[model samples]
Target: MKESEKHISHFDIVVIGGGASGMMAAGTAAARGKRVCIVEKNNELGKKLKITGGGRCNITNATYDIHALLSMYGKAHKFLYTPFSLFGVNDTFRFFEERGLPLVVEAGNRAFPHTHNAHDVFRVLEKYCIDNGVVVMLDAPVERMVMCRTKARIDAIETSKGSITARAYIFATGGASHPETGSTGDAFHWLKDMGHTVTPPSPNIVPLRTAESWVHTLSGVSVDSMKITFLVDGVKKFHKTGKILFTHFGLSGPLILNSAHTIADMLHEGVVTASVDVVPHLAHGDLDKHIQEIFSEHKNKNFKNVAEYIAPHGMAVSLMMMPGMPLSDTKVHSITKEERKHIVHTLKDMRCTITGLMGMDKAVVSDGGVPLGDIDLKTMRSRLVDNLYITGDLLHINRPSGGYSLQLCWTTGWIAGSCAE
Candidate 1:
């Protein structure tokens, strides 16, 4: 087929989804002498990326060991090793730093620009694309992909604005998380229709809503270094130790979001229960002894007055309301051993009912997309379609926060763009 006859709005590459990966792929391809165009549904590019890491944009983790980095991901760890080996953390660090965006590694090795602005990350990519002659079609949503069966290639992509044709196509539309940011699982449906296996998308790094009403009162209270354990069918299946934030609805933060996946799985099968060890560092016996000592020392004082030192600030009042303790009438000297045990148990195991997940609107990342087995990891090119490639959260790769997701985007985007020819 003639080059002019085969295309409508012709380019060397047409990248669908103007997200992190899409921008990266377009810029990289354009840099490599490939004419590139990006079709973005939103009026602005990198809307989601702009707000990532609470607007700081956790660029990448500082870890260089491929094995240790792979271990961060659950089952998807093995699939990512090949890609990481090609363009791992070191490449990600250099990619930004070389572009005048120096990165700083924080407490958990989470890398962010020295300015800590997500806009800077976007600026670097935007500047790179413009400098390399990449065309960006803003407010253009890809309606459908037209594939030529005889050639087994994507001939053209129909967008809301118009049609564009290219020799190669890259999908980096992200996942269903933060639909307000324009990610609504459109890529998954598009890929599924094109004969690729797409996993059912679910809320991954999202908050969990609890059934308890009192939890709402504790909104904005963050517990650091707490161990959260998820129970399925009365069996403790998942557990993680980190920081968690109590919201008006329930719980969130790094630990809670990661545990939500396990909780969702258990909830699908049956009922699930969640327990938080607020003072995980303290042994039960040690905690009990500590409480006993506090009570003995404050024997002459009122029970309510002594409770403040043992529990978290503002939590003592809530604990005093539970079963035995009478905040108004009981004195520390009159408090029985049984009541003290209850307080100790409450302090150790603060239980909450797992009502439901917060949904994609609040998710940090969504879990579901084109199955990994359906795409070639080396090139990020589709196994079914000859010229079609997938990248970012659109590919089913389970990962946690702290810059792993963005790194995946960078690696896969670079690979897809490099292989576009």
Candidate 2:
């Protein structure tokens, strides 16, 4: 053995990458009276979890129906049934709420801790590990897995700290997204070397950049109820309704993030664009009548003075100031009938060209990991390597934002921890 490899430490289970799944798996194993150690590259764990949902931490989507929740994962739904059936969303709620971190459901059935502090969620997992006697090795970046080729199992792993030998190993190193949080694609390469088919990852759930500077000025503004339609060369492709948030670069929020993948595909075909209807529920006649009432209410007022009443909250300035929009100096009563119709049209069809999606750096979740065919999702164990298991973003599953990603971590981690023999 080499000098570093000679310093071997033994454990009943060794979990790599102390983000969401690794921490869960280590704590679960330790609770079962196994000697467990969690290795993390970062000085602290849960860097990504800490900032998820803007630090409020959307713990899981409260979709109680197993079939309904699984559908969100796209193609991997079939592979996931076994794991989730064993440790499903209800189990997730029981696990945390019993431990004193109660979760509350909000719009879209998205769940968060009542405190809404992500750090508290991390603390719950951390406390689980500490109470169960799991050893944590922070800042110990793993170099490579030492595989027993003939036995088809991981014999040990080389890390900056030293070599670690475990009866079973769980890899939860996450996929490439938010690299600043330490979820780099190091494990994907290692799995490829082991002959696993690692899919090349791309930013899946991310924000879109737009061509309009007017959109940029509305940064930090969000429309609670709106509809956005995507098109290619002026032909409608698809549309979704919910909420949309404007960023300095473009558009975001749950609605936009979920649409990014499809929009990305559309971008490849031709020039992609979008039309935002600020008041989707209002028909043309209804909206026009509403605007007429607002105009009559302030008959002598300048257009800009009453723009806020017609436009979405906090967006009147930017929308009214658009190049072709009615001049702010124009009196509301003097506004031409054609201009009145134009205003209604603009509200219904707020046009903007989609430039592109933000890269991996801004991605909430990236798809690409070992295909489900190579995983026994029943136990999250590798089909080829008997004693090796995979969890979290390491498994190729395409899911939208909101709480699906973290729920995957919890479900897979629990099953792997329970079944790792």
Candidate 3:
């Protein structure tokens, strides 16, 4: 049989990329009695969704105030007003709860499956698609879109397997980050060819790589709470405070991942540095007094041994090893006034030179995709292309982690699915 003729099917709606948004869109459309087909390049569905929140898919934020939720999106918050109003976070909670999937809230109002299994979330979404009669075509990567000369609508989709003609098409190919999850920014180029404006993708929630090799020695080390200040050309640019992790490559965890976008941009222009405050809650005077107390209590102990109480064990050792700082073997009581001041400073602000980002593969999510101007906010239908809807990371919206990104998927996917003609 010819490759072109071996796999061809028709549907009322065809959704590309079977991640969070595509699956939701396909399921919703199919539930409305539309013959929906999902085209996914991966062998399985929701490859990315299966790995979110370290494999415990954060479904949505527990923040119920619409205003507060919107503010979390920053500038893109305005564009989400209509979509989220239709299917806000509360609606998201209900959608899953009604489907027999209970969610639990964490420290930051992040809602995850009660079972804490991302695979469970994917299972539910896949089951939703099946229950609604949506046909999924896996390993069917799209090649191009067939467009009409006189109309702003897709006629057919040219794919790696064959061509699929649909009355309505939804592109949810996602952003360029985590290419291993099959999000290679394919739709950005395809949409550009279809005359839609696309924002070039950049690593948004990526980790930072430090120039210091000592950072690698601190691998697997984590601070429950700390503050990091981004400095360009030796001047402060911005700061973030939260859980921080030291990796073999550099700094990561919640704080560094969220700050990578700005840091990446700054690194492109000039030398970027970071000052990590291990104890931001303590004032200089208070920290000095605290250190004095610790020294007095451990006067006979090595300085390194006493420093452990002030910072992570790895951090304490690193501080003592810093140039001109006190020796690790020095007794806590023997440390001079100058050394005491240095110890205080190190506890407050340990510095590092940030060389670059940890690469897109290590990024939690990427920012920028198809700009919002190309799609109608109310319906999610493309203004430039009729019979076409865009949803999820495929659209250029910079969102932070902690359920904001997945919420975008649920809101836009529902809108695109419900409003598609």
Candidate 4:
């Protein structure tokens, strides 16, 4: 049978996954006069994008230097130089702003809509796709790819609904993170079967569950300007100072999530421990002196009464219950010098045993997919499959939360769409 007769559906470009990259790729390709069709497993497009940045949709970071921006991905930094240079963060701002969506930079160079609604970001992409004549197949899961061995290319994609044929294909099905959004690592298996070197996917930007149950009581309380350090086998691997929230499971927020990638690896090796410096800016000796002053001033008051001034609301109550701390009924002046030191140590280095990471269902972005060496960074096209392209979390790039992940989608999707023949 002829190539055209064997395939069920035909298009100039077929994008699997109606996510940030898939939608962007389809829209960009269709805008350039290519017949485009997007196959998405989810009923709605940009489901994960809609909930990002706490529903504000952190659009992109405002880092102008390509090197500085790439540095956020660590080892994956080198592979991103070409893609960022082609469609950097600045280009992303221009791309969205030009389409009538102006972005506002929030704390830490994170960009979001002025209205602070993630749905608006999705709306723009939806409009762009519709305006450019891109066909969207919602609720369609791609089951496998039909490779043309003679041409050494991906000739067609088989989905739960049916098969789709295209001259070129882009896979932006995302990773195993946020399973409710339909990202379940299905694309990884399909690509692995096609002879691509696939990295085992794991939860990256996810919350860490601790062995201590006291952390649950501290849920909803966030520590600002705090420092969190991840130590692997007694060696500190990574540390970052920012804000983190106490969760029912353990720790979360910006700092904890960013450190989750390294923590997950440590947990796999054996056991990982995290130390939180609530008062990172204060020196240990200085904090000790300060506490002495507080003790002297509140000598007549109960130990618990003095806690309110020294710690943030609710923290004092939790701290008093920590190991070796005397009851709240004890007089502040009655506390011993050694006890004071213990209190200071507890405040400075609140230790938590990291048992494991939350599942992909809670991860912001998953780590694992097509290995970096398997794709051409310049065009984001697969080195093994001539007509295939990869983008977004589907690539094995570890990036901190902000707008880095979405910016990646924009950069890779744009390059892949433009380069697709």
Candidate 1 lDDT, tens digit per residue, 77-140?
8788888988889999899999999999997899999999999999999998899999999988
What TM-score should be assigned to candidate 3? 0.95
Error of 3 at 98 (Å): 0.5
Off by over 4 Å in 1: 1-8, 296-302
User: Where does candidate 2 stray beyond 4 Å?
Assistant: 1-6
Model 4 per-residue lDDT tens digits across residues 258-311: 878777667777668887777887899998999999999889899988987776
lDDT of each: 0.86, 0.91, 0.87, 0.86
Ranking by TM-score: 3, 2, 1, 4
CA displacement after TM-score superposition, residue 20 of candidate 1 (Å)? 0.8
**Cα deviation in Å at residue 260, candidate 3?**
1.9
Which of the two, 1 or 2, has more lDDT? 2
If ranked by lDDT, best first, what sequence of candidates would result?
Answer: 2, 3, 4, 1
For candidate 1, list the clashing residue pairs, or say none: none
Which candidate should be chosen as best, given lDDT against the real structure?
2
Better of 1 and 2 by TM-score: 2
Q: Estimate each model's TM-score.
A: 0.94, 0.95, 0.95, 0.93
Backbone clashes in candidate 3 total: 1
State residue 321's C-alpha deviation in candidate 1, in Å. Answer: 3.9
Note each model's CA RMSD in angstroms: 2.9, 1.8, 1.7, 2.6
